[model samples]
Target: MTRTTALVIAVAMTFTAACGGGDDAAPETTAAPAASPTTAAAEPDDATDDAVTDDAVSDEGTNDDPANGATDEVAGDDPPTEEPAGDDSSTDDSPVADPEPADGFSWRAPADGEPILIGMVNTEGVPGLDFPEMRTDLDRAVAYLNDHGGLGGRPIVMEHCRAAGSPDSSQECAQSLTGKGVDMVLLGLDIFPGYTTFSAAGVPVFGALPILRSDYSADAQFVTGGNLTTMGVIAAIAVEHIGAQSVGIVSADNIGANTSETDLTNALTAAGIDYVSIKGGDNETDAGFQALIREAAAGDPDLLVSLYSDAGCIGAMRGRALLGIDTPAISTAICAGSDVLDVVGDDAAGWMFVGVGESDDSMASIEFEAMLDDGSGDGASGAGLGALAVTMIGTLARVANMLAADGVAVDGDAIAAVMASGDAPGSFPNGETIHCGVVAAFPSVCGFSLPVGYYTDDGDVATLPGFDSVSAIDYLP
Candidate 1:
């Protein structure tokens, strides 16, 4: 399954868990079929296998009621209530406060004000790669932002357009959004290499995750670091935290995957760690996956890394478990989804991922949960793999705050100016500040820092210690 599908499944599973009263039942154990050592040595080469397609690695990129469309407004519109100083009793005429949750995040309602339109372009309707959940999350985030004092007290109006995973379609969507006179644009994970459409139209574009190479360098686009930068962080963690002397990498045999592998190899070599890499088809068979893992394990490397798609991740985990290999493993956050957990079961317990921030406990995470509680974002029982929705919400809030603080009119030109002036607002979920154009090659990557985390059998994540510094690894192209 693709990451997008994994997210949909995860949201559905979250609802199931919630309906089941958050039970902590353990997954049933099953005996996996053992693989022979000869099977590993006789694995077919990926270079000549046409059957192994790159569907899983293709970057085509959940959901509450599953039926409630993005048009529905979130609940609560009252301002945040303040407690009386040194007094417990409330006045008979005083307005009643909203009940606080056990997690301690105070909820507030969207402010009443003029609407500011923000455009969004996402890939949807393409076979095996639609992301309607992203639009839904954006809608929920806008509603929440409006309740909590939206852009200078102006409510946000979202104008959305869908692309069919093609450059022409992406360009058309950009035009459609611009025609609506949107103040700015938010991009979802699109493989379409047409960011220039937005830049040429003079609209400032930002996204939770960057997928294409153009997205990393476009002057008008900004994104939280995508797979490339995340790989660098992973390399740093392997050498620093895991104390890995040697690393083995398995990635899809695609252009994007190739670029990621090269960057990761550079980072590892720079850190003085020896490494070996193998490429496999994006939709590798179970035997293909086993061969890749066995080859990596044969080296007795301290760390085994998987940069494949969601399904590939599942294949790797299963392969590892079947072989009874216990070498510590790490992968991108794409692997930490519900589908993978459901498939791999206990095998996912110690699999670590490079993430943007600490999970569940960070200030940003607390705010993210509060927004979800107020009927914003996906409203899943737990924050899933990517945290894309949370990243989008936090990024937009910072942009809105920057505009508010400067008394600048909310418009494409003004927003672009604010971003270019290097006065971008707010830190990442990990409390790391973002300065656009920090790296000359990847100019649009606003934040370079990342946190590490491992998965729990319950589909939750536990944070690990690693490189949190943008300067820890060099990311020059």
Candidate 2:
């Protein structure tokens, strides 16, 4: 393949974890890039396969009443007391009436207020991996926040540093931002996180998602959990929703991929579900993919999970179709991309997904899309990791607003404390309820719940009933 083609494929590989693990994911404690992931299946030359087999053993408040769409109290909670009917009269009542409902946040910046410096570090300018859209979308989100309410009337000034796909580069960016006295640092697809640097400098760190294994155990905080959480949730879905006793997982054979696979296996074992795993490389031929699928289905498991992304997604789907294996399958949101759908076509039907949700026309959605359009010149769209960056900024603004409303200073330490203490509000834009520090191994994953959905015959996504906001904290390692 040409250099440009290889780079393009690499970008697509990074779009989702191509093989249970991320194509661009670096090992923990190191920032070295992995081999470039391929977008096309190579022609099968040999017929040799390696397999490893192992067998192993929500929200606060009321639960969702599926019958009436109402909240049901927990089994042991005291029942709410009912007031007397038609008790409109009151003794010694004032002339005040109830206040009007709020439309939305309308906090405006104070006159000539000081700017709060928020540091950001993102990977960019790398040969096969670049994500400037992350910074662009975050800038727009900050702009939106400034226009609405500038972090308790103190305008936010973003201090952006670019990392060139290496640990040294990431460290340099962290040092530069810390030297500037930034309040806290936000990470965007940074392979080598500088948590120690920020912690030593007494600066809090926040990121959209935990991309590396080090991120899971880092002192820093992340709003979204990547492979670790996603896989765990998928395992939850397999047991709770699909009612599958046996699950077969097909994954790529990479360090990151194996780590994620182990997470799924552990979750399954904890849930008392049987699971089998099959592995392959990023560049598998059509026949090779079919062979892997056939092997995974050999045991006639109740569910099949494909942890492939990019071209791997297409290969898995096509392999299932070619083999006529109609067993219900599950995959990640990476496979839900338009590029994959356009190629997989109807073959993607009956495939449930983790980390994928149906689109809505809610006001929040409209506002988010509008922000993306408003900053189109800066490549501000909801493709790739741009929307995630925006989510990070919005989440920060939300915590700051909450703190300010309570007469607390809108500083990095306070925000970080609230997040670490699990008192932060719902994630911005989507408002997914989050619980931080719930999983000991994944203390940084504040947003542990994920929306589960499936692809339709027309390639449209739809949410699975009773699977919305599935939490993986119980299954996390």
Candidate 3:
């Protein structure tokens, strides 16, 4: 199932527990869900707490449900005490394994092949902002790679580190991954401030999502979009396609969102488009969003742009709908989430946004769909071409393709060398090409262009004709 579907299932299952109002007793303690094998280094208990919170507020609202008075009737209900001799019941009572694929979607690696170890760092355990799904996606991609001719016939193995949205946790993960002799590091939507650690150790780091200043300029770090290029594309679309000569921005009050605002401002000014920017809380309330939207629209902007998180996006859309404003609207990819769309309903239709990959019928997209169908990657989450599944699978596929082309053994040093040689593969999952070190301000940004798409009345995103390349836009120093 898609990530959206999975989230819906989770929400349905817990809706009663979240919204039930009659109970007044303490809730029962349940076993935490198991972390995916790829997240081997994560603290299970800590991660589980965040996961539960994410599920509880998947739609970002509070319910008046009193604590359920449920308790374990049999406190010591562990497994049976008796052992079943040679054929132990506990050991042998395994579920049936999934049937092997009957088509080409099967593992092709030699059984005894050497393993190619790739390190991954992701953010998790931060309440309401964890991304266990990122690690899960990478794990699924590695499994798919191993099944479809592992990197140069070597099985791909991922060693993961959980940053948990803290500098210390990030550093610890970097240090641990470096010490493990990993070939390269994949930064999966991490807010870690420790890319320097990997760079100092001469390890090349590839970013699935570039969310920090270091992500743009760090030596040996290459990312899908450098320094808000994706936002730049959104700005371009606002001016070019939407006929928006004057634009207003509702930006999240965060470092990354501020950077995006600056980038977009530069692009809009260069294009001779008039623009005004206003800041809002990343998790603004409905009233706060209405006021911000009204204030921004008061200037008679031709278009409204939301550079906030999904929550802020929902608020902005609701605010606009309430005011009956019809100005063309656009948002960052994060704002186009399934939850946001569901909340906004028909109001989301005709809104434009930027994405990293194409939704077209390219061979890559076809293969990606097949992988998802075969359960090879985490279902879609995130926005644009760099959705969780796309980024994980695309980044790894590029790496594997590069190694296979050179007939080189997959090793850390060799991979780093290739990345630094200025000839590393740059094809994204959406069939876009990126060249690292091409921009002075964003030296490590690979893909500097983004695809534009509009939401339909049915809440589906439809890609426009072509992508917007903002390479000429000046970058902030």
Candidate 4:
């Protein structure tokens, strides 16, 4: 199914699934970027593939009453006293991104002011959704902004909303955040297609990168990132960086994928790479993934780019390990997480993925130190990986804070603008902010481009891509 369909189905059935590994992620410790990732170039599989999902956390953390929609409790807390934001809206399926940003509006403070509450929502270790480590990373991001900057003299107050097991609950969560009179919202619709709800609520979210393509700029929405165009960029990276003359395409077996497949194929062709697929990138199984990887690997492509997930990463690692297909495996930002690096151990050594943030441009380094002070350094390599994660968290918050400081007044729109075309400069890698979002196509923003490193490897596992690239390209996305 497409992202939206998948979400709809996931929510409609009241089924809970675990995604990404839990606290199993250990931070990297070795210093600055070293050892750029090596893919050993070639072609990808002719057959398509998919990503993997983990088991969801207990009902207590997210919501026990899956059938009840978004009235979730705080796991350990008593019953919630608030009314629910019922699932009550529909959406269209056009990938056309919201318009390019218009001339921005300057802040004109209205004298008498009550604090404008900004409602923020993220995957704060949501029960089933663990891929986006919101709490340790995202939470620190907010703190950094508030402590160092504080939005234009008005402090930002955030309410952490949990993602529901079902899409109904997802809508509920969005509605609930809207009902709170949040001036703007920073949200992600990947785990919850709450776009419809937010749109209906007339809340213009700014920071979220929704997986589904809806009217973000309508009275209902606002989007900033280089939307549908990014697909071509993704394909180009697979062809150039991964050196794949030929690639096996994989997509979610849903309407959304169907809509985009033609464009993706055309883009790949325009980029001068060969691609072929038979659907089934969104929903998949371990055994199916293994067979799929085998088929893809058989193509002997220099790069193995799969639209897969952590679970699928695991399966692909195992499948390749079983068959010994050691070419580099590249994927989207969706699967990019520090934890994913540790999932397959030695097998994960050469795994390459993509996503936002410039190495120097992001706040991961600064946040790492902060996390160390906050005690997240315990089991982790302490400052090493913990530091990196802290930096990642700090990066997002810094961007959010900057938008807030500029008084852009919308989370999704501001973040999207920054991601797609924000032009202000900030620290990245060694400290450089070249473009607004990620200027050129993103193999970098699509991923951190980390080389395989381990504490036991006796080399720097903490830093990625030979340090210089961190500053050279700027990892901030």
The top-ranked prediction according to TM-score is 2
lDDT of 4 at 118: 53
Specify the poorest-scoring 10-residue window by lDDT in model 4. 5-14
Winner on TM-score between 1 and 3 is 1
Clashing pairs in 1: 109-147, 110-146, 110-147
In the range 1-477, model 4's lDDT, one tens digit per residue, is: 111100000000000100000111223432221222121001112111122122222122232332222112111111112211221123366453321111110111211223345554543243333323333333433343344332332344555465533455555567677777776665432344466677677665543222333422322221222223334434545544455677665545554445345545665666677766545555466667667777766666665555444465466556555667666555433333334435655565454432222221122322233332433333212211122233332334345545655666534456445644545323211222323324343311312222111222321132223311111122122
Candidate 1 lDDT tens digits, 1-477? 112221111111100000000111212332111111000000111121132222221121112343322422333332224432223345687666533111112242354566766777766665544666566655545555666666555666666667666666666777776666767787754555356666677677776655655666765444356555566666767756677789988877776577667767878877788999988886888899999999987889888888775688789888887888877787765565555666777777557655522333333444444444434444442334223554555555666555755677665566556555666654423444456676777777666655554554445544443233333336334
Q: Over the full model, what C-alpha lDDT does candidate 4 score relative to the true structure?
A: 0.36
Off by over 4 Å in 4: 1-116, 122-132, 135-137, 163-175, 189-203, 215-233, 249-266, 278-290, 333-340, 356-364, 368-374, 379-422, 426-477
lDDT of 3 by residue, 9-111 (tens): 0010000000001111111221111111000000111122233322111101111111210011101111112221233234466763422221111323331
Please report the TM-score between candidate 2 and the true structure: 0.75
What are the per-model C-alpha RMSD values against the true structure? 9.3, 15.2, 15.4, 14.7
- Each model's lDDT: 0.53, 0.60, 0.51, 0.36
Measured by lDDT, the strongest candidate is 2
lDDT of 2 at 381: 30
Model 2 over residues 53-169: C-alpha lDDT tens digits? 111000111223222111121111111122122222364675533211111232233312466777778777664346677766566556555665556556766667777656667
Q: How accurate is candidate 3 locally (lDDT)?
A: 0.51
What is the TM-score of candidate 1?
A: 0.74
How does each model score on TM-score? 0.74, 0.75, 0.71, 0.54
